[model samples]
Target: MSRSTPRPEPFVSATSAAALNDLRTRLRATRWPDSPADAGWSLGVDVGYLHELVDYWADEFDWAAQESALSRHPRFRVEIGDLNIHFVHARAVSPVGPALPLVLSHGWPDSFWRYSKVVSLLTDPGAHGADPADAFDVIVPDMPGYGYSDRPTGPPLNSIDVAGLWAELMRILGYSRYGAAGGDIGSAVSRYLALDNPESVVAVHRMDAGLPVFTGDRADLSPQEQEFLDSSAAWGSTEGAYAAMHRTKPQTAAVGLTDSPAGLAAWIVEKLRGWTDCDGVIERSFSKDEILTNITLYWLTGTIGSSMRMYNANGSIPSEQHARRVEVPSGFSFFSGDLFARPPRAWLDRVANVVRIKELPRGGHFAPFVEPELYAQELRDFFRPYRKALG
Candidate 1:
């Protein structure tokens, strides 16, 4: 079979002046929600803190600077199947050996912006004092319906469908074989890429093992594994409410999120603070500009609704995909501050061909962006052994 050549076109994100003005107006006119006496983040986003953030977003945050910085990367759009995928195709600048191609997928509440911190570090390791041989030609894509990519107007696309698109994307980019890495929903996408196209994906690395992929009898799992499952359920009871809303009633929530910048920030920033190792201070993990930049992307692109719809699509993935064991070599990194507890080796072994597992001293769910140096080094070490396969 002949591979299709991709017609790549340069892509840049530019929010209209009117849109910026409207966002400011909405932020200024935000309907304030009253907080219970002494209420902090326990009852969702703290109204006090949110008001402060809204003030910064309205009067001080710089969207144009962030947009310009984002456009500095070599971004491009390529048509694949029914969607036009937007991706950053950065090549190794001073290679010492093979510049292995690596595709990185981003999760929700984020776009390709999730990988902006680590792209250059991975692509040119020598500049960062690492072995130039560790360099990778990084490819970070904004999955369909997120960021600059076309949103699904028909049936929502799941991780499986996006994985298929990613496989074809790599093929179209002239990579017959490559490595895959990601976190959050991205972790699931990388797993699906390995499951659905193992021949082409040499190895895969993820921050989380994703929703537990199990098969056979429950009797097979160790007691600790069972406890982990129980803890997951408990976590879901509290942390999972938003997911349920996304799965069942995204449109209801999307209406407010899409219409009001403050509403969107309130929804997304809570997760950012809760899921990160910020010790209850969001500014510890992200600057006001950084936080607002991400929120503003959702606001400007009008993608909050489409992004939420992905949960509905994911909920419908066939049981067989959940049960399918990933045969490709897999690696896992458990960042200490991540929202979900790290799965035991026994649990991960049930789903993937586990080759490496490491627990970092710091970082949380958004590790790639929060701790790019550590995250990039982890990728370099894990994929080091697989580089020969690309030869």
Candidate 2:
């Protein structure tokens, strides 16, 4: 470890009994909202489902079990710059040779929890019926304001700033070169990692190219590119109010979310249902426990405000940053139900040194969590050739 970077101490996820009691108290006392007849998710989070979910959350959901499950992975907290970052650092087991170091960045409505299932599969591939040579030393960090990590006091760190922090974190851990992968804000962070620290980041992978932004002439774009841009705008108008709140008035929205567990659950669960490949049945994609565990983390941390503020910061990123083309080798996996999964190859080529692109038949925006085995296989396949080059 470098002398300049402080050593990381082992961390365990433990919530006090008092906090648990408070959560149940709030869940029990939730003032119910009324929805029109047969209003099943037509308006924000279906009230009927929210009631059932909240009932389970109050009486049935097990935080201790979830916390224990989270702690089973080797977790740590280290100070990088002014913030103390919480990350899961699971090293490869029984590698055939040198294992490639890989950092996995997570996006909003979730944290390190997003990559929890894939960690062991990635770290110990042979045990999971994969080649030992495909093992990776995995690092999953809670982007500064999420989960157990410390929230930034000043302006929320944008994707570019988070990318720099990730690079320094890898440096502190003694990884001279590593690969980066992420989705949502994580996608943007990984993109910046490849763009700004190409030498250190050997290659990069992203779930989506993010909402399209072009500063160049409209005539320069292909018809497909133009249509993709138009469709993205439509998505924003219909399904992006939550994002609009995050970017424009986070504190105003966060007040209710941070105070009420039901509000928090409604906010996060709506996305989980809308974004995952559950076909309108959230339980098909995530159990009540899985859903509540993620929501409870937000309630306990009280950092929902800070996490949303990241959008406001990112909204201010310069136009040139959005236009910059990445030279680093890049791969993408566009899952069937994700937001704009099949991004035009032309648009991808314009921004990245497109090496590979795969469109899986299933899964959604939260692919790693929704389909861990498939997601793990995608990483192994995409980075296998790059691993040979590293040697």
Best by lDDT: 2
**lDDT score at residue 252, model 2, on the 0-100 scale:** 98
Angstrom error at residue 265, model 1 = 0.2
Model-by-model lDDT, in order?
A: 0.90, 0.92
Show pairs that collide, candidate 2. none
lDDT by residue (tens digit), candidate 2, 348-388: 99999999999898889999999999999999998888786
Q: How high is the lDDT of residue 274 in model 1?
A: 94
- Model 2 poorest ten-residue lDDT run: 334-343
Please, what are the lDDT tens digits per residue for candidate 1 over residues 219-284? 888988988887887888979999999999999999999988889999999999999998889899
